[model samples]
Target chain A: MTQRDHQQKKMQIRDGFIAGSPIVMGYLPIALAYGVLAQQSGMSLMELTGMSLLVFAGAAQFMGANMIAFSASAIEIIVATFVLNFRHFVMSLSFVNQLKRIALPWKFSLTLGLTDETFSVSSIYRKQANQAYGQYFYGTLILVAYLSWVFGSLLGGLLGDVIPPQLSQSMGVALYAMFIGLLIPSVKKQHKIILISVTAMIVNYLLQPMIGEGWGIVAGTLVGGVAGIFVLDEEENT
Target chain B: MIWMIIIGMAVVTLIPRIIPAFIVDFVDFPNWVNKWLEAIPYAALGALIFPGIITVVPEQPLIGIVAGIVAIMCAWFRLHIMVVVLSAIATVFVLTL
Candidate 1:
């Protein structure tokens, strides 16, 4: 590329990193908690880093750690995590639409870093911009998020003993609060979001202990998403 | 043994995220399909958070509730996400003391 093109590309990558800063900030406390939890559950530092590196998924990694503590079978752990992360499939599809022009190798690498937060940040950026961002934009965004997650886990694993128990326990609340922060704004825009959300919450709560933890979420999302389609169409027509 | 489980989980999780991007064409999604896709984030976050609040601070459910409320207020006012998260964590910490 020309000098001007290279300059512009660097600028986009910087913007991507800046846009992803909040998510990295958000991931730190939560991932720290994950590290502490994984350590407390008897994961070695190497084991902890390996899981964070390979899995790179927060909820599933937490769940997998819990199952490991119970000495649950390997297949069970694999299947359970797979089910918990099924939402990524939907996210990838949505992202593919906006990122259609990205090269295949770059798209594959970026997809590996896709999380709920990264997807949200990238998609919001895509919608606001007239054109798709270059590969560097996504690369930097994912790079920051990935570093926070892995490093947070590593720190938690190594220093978990030094932190006081009450403080560590308090850290668990940070993630759920972050989720609320992400959810409420969107809910305010469309009232139907509330309906879809509440319905899913109720379904998940009721079904979790019976059918299996992961399936409850799956069932709830399907019901809520289907319900939202009808509600959104009605609102649009009115 | 642990390595095997870790690798297994990675492979399974990789499929859902990677396969669709590789094979699926972006154009020509029906409107209803887009609507359905749009709804996933709301419903997914809701389901994950609501039930988690009670359980996350099980010994002190009230702290979790307060933190969640504080988070919603911060988000509603359009505060930075980091501020919202830190404030909520502070609420829980102070409450537990």
Candidate 2:
């Protein structure tokens, strides 16, 4: 509100924007893959764009589109997506604390950009910054991600099955690589992360062939995360 | 139906992020919950990443897995983003040739 406060806010936005640039390296290819997948799924340009506008999360959107291509019922598609994406809720809990003092409407916009990549990037920036422009910094990052995803989907939609199947399939590697990059920074902290990683792999592998593909994500998250806590508690107490 | 999808996306996305706000109001969690919480992202990212790595590749199933390794290593080294990307792309490129 004050002149000094406003200036500081502007500076935070600028640095957040600069720091956030690397995230685009991750977003662009993933978005491009989303685009390619959407096309392969037979989504019309409008439907793909509509998804980009509404759903926005790349993996969930891909899942939803793939389900639609298979003639999945609307309920099935929506539920599957919700299950796949529920981890964002966990990401947001701590995320919202900083904006606890900001107004409701701005918080709403910040939530839009709270996709996994955005959450990781912005949260790191927020820790370095004072509260002055937490909202602004997040806003810029989300805006860039949102635009990249939508546009990439649009390009994929337009390209439409032209991409070779091998290339199409290989695109899945981009996001997996991003995940590994994210993990390197925190991998050393505790046995808990190591245990959790092992648990997630086991749960996913065990559950996928038995329970189902889409369902494993929801199950793996809860089972793996909870299992890690129990194991940690026992180890720490003993 | 469209509105439902839009609203569904909005609510689902909103709920996960907001759970801790009202969540603590009703339920109490133990201290270990903090350690569990720290690994949540890795848990989530692993779910996504595992499928990419383990899914069998076609022409050379080995190439497919190798591509995943190369890309992640390139990315890990903080190699130029374009190079990291091209590493995977080139892996597929050579194999396809």
Candidate 3:
């Protein structure tokens, strides 16, 4: 590659790392909690970290650990995981659609790192910055976030007993805090989002008793998306 | 047996995430479909935050709520995400103490 091309690539990687740093901070506490919970559930350090490495999903892994603790069958846990992660289908579709010009290979590998945090950060970064960042940027962002998760899980699994219980419990709020931070900008841009988001939250809340949290999220997002189609203006930029 | 369950969970999770990338290349979504897709993040964020936030501190749900409100306030000012998160954590720590 030319000198300018190489320099630009370096910049993209640096920018991506910067963009991903907050997600790293957010994931550490949550992943640590996951490790502690998984370890408590009788998962070996290898098994817990293996799940983080392979699965790379926060909510599903937590649920999987919980089910294991309860002695839920393999079939039940797998099915529950599929149902919980079904939201990723929409997220991956949106991500692919956004970076349509990028190569298929990049899209394939990048989607593997697509979690709730990464997807929200990327989408908001795209809309707010109005820049179609390079695949290198996304690649680096995903890499850092993924590493932090795995490392945090390893630490939490090993030190599950060392950390104070109350402190770890308080750390549970970190992810939700990050979510709120991501959501506020969009809500400010479009008042319609407030309605859509509230609708989703209420729907999830009401349905959690019957359909469960996993399905509740899926149903909530679908209903809220449909609400968006009507509530959001056609001329409005998403 | 545990390994089997873990592997099974991995496969099921990977399928949903990876399949959509390949499919998006073949299909061209209509405009309305695109709009719906655009809204997914916000909706999903909403669902992910609620109920989960309230239940974060299982023993004292109020601590979670107070921390959540602190997060919303920090975010409203457009503070950095880390600041928002840290502030919320601090709120929880203080409340629990």
Candidate 4:
């Protein structure tokens, strides 16, 4: 890279770090609570920390811990987790174009860190950062968030009562609340999006008994995602 | 007892992470497929956030959920990320109290 290229790359990295800080701030408390909740639900420190680093999605880990606490079989937990995380595969596909220039390690590592928050920050900066530097910046974001989550779990496991019950219950809403922060920018004039989402919610509520957790998320996410995607494309065409 | 189970889960969880890293150095997904994946993240966020805003809150779960949805809508339209969060928390607190 030339001097200008190098300077530009540095700027992109800085942007990623800056934009991602807000999300990291949002994530720390929730990750901490997830850790504590995992232990409370009978998960050992190792399991909770592993999910923080490996699985990395708070929602799935929360559900997984619930399943494990109930003494669900490995197969059931695996299937449940697979269903809960099926959207991840879809996310992996998102990086295909942007990641084409990077080496395989970067691609693979980027995929590992592709959580909702990470994707939002990284994708916003990808054009400026390019594939290689975008992955590096995103990795930095992941490392920070992952450390917070791991340490949070450790703290919660060891320092249980230091955090009040009222606070912990309140922190439980943080993840969902973060979802609100994310959804705000997108609930634009796309009526199909609104319609598709409402339909999926109804479908999920109706299918709660028959399809169960794994199938419900899988079917609902696809139906909703595809319907919203296609419908918007048609609207833009006109 | 839970510690032992945690150890076991740690091992299981690492497989998914390590497998793709080791086996697939670079992925080559087709362009058309890529187009669809672009929509997945926003759609997924939408689905997750919607139910969260509408769910029954625990203390005063019923009213909190409704109030939260309204608070979020106002803050969102105003483009204030912080206000959205604070309002939701305040709504829950008010509904419960």
Q: Model 3: which docking level applies? A: medium
lDDT of each: 0.78, 0.64, 0.86, 0.59
- How accurate locally is residue A78 in candidate 2, as Cα lDDT from 0 to 100? 75
Candidate order, TM-score descending: 3, 1, 4, 2
Query: Can you tell me the DockQ of model 2?
Result: 0.40
Instruction: List, residue by residue over A1-238, the lDDT tens digit for candidate 1.
Output: 7888878788888988887787777787667878888887788889988999998999899998888888899999998888888878777776665576777777888899888777766655553233334777877888899899999899888877555778767777766776787777777777667888788788888887897666777777677777778776443311
Q: Whose DockQ is higher: candidate 1's or candidate 2's?
A: 1
lDDT of 1 by residue, B1-97 (tens): 8889889999988888887677755456777877776676667777767677876668767778888889999989999877888888888889888
Residue A70, candidate 3: how far off, in angstroms?
A: 3.5
Over A89-128, each residue of candidate 4 has an lDDT whose tens digit, in order, gives: 5545554444555667666766666665666555544554
lDDT of 3 at B54: 87
Q: Per-residue lDDT tens digits of candidate 3, residues B1-97?
A: 8888889988888888889889889998888988888788788888888888988878778888899889989988889888998999889888888
Question: Once model 4 is optimally superposed onto the true structure by TM-score, how far is the C-alpha of residue A132 displaced, in angstroms?
Answer: 7.2
List TM-score (chain A only) for every prediction: 0.80, 0.75, 0.91, 0.76
- Displacement of residue A209 (Cα, Å) in model 2 is 2.2
> Runs in model 1 with CA error above 4 Å?
A2-4, A36-43, A101-103, A123-135, A233-238
Q: Among these predicted structures, which one has the highest DockQ? A: 3
Cα lDDT for residue A129, model 4?
38
| Model 1 steric clash pairs | none
Tens digits of per-residue lDDT for model 3 on A144-190?
A: 99999999999999988665878877787888998899999788877
TM-score of chain B of 2: 0.58
Best model per TM-score: 3
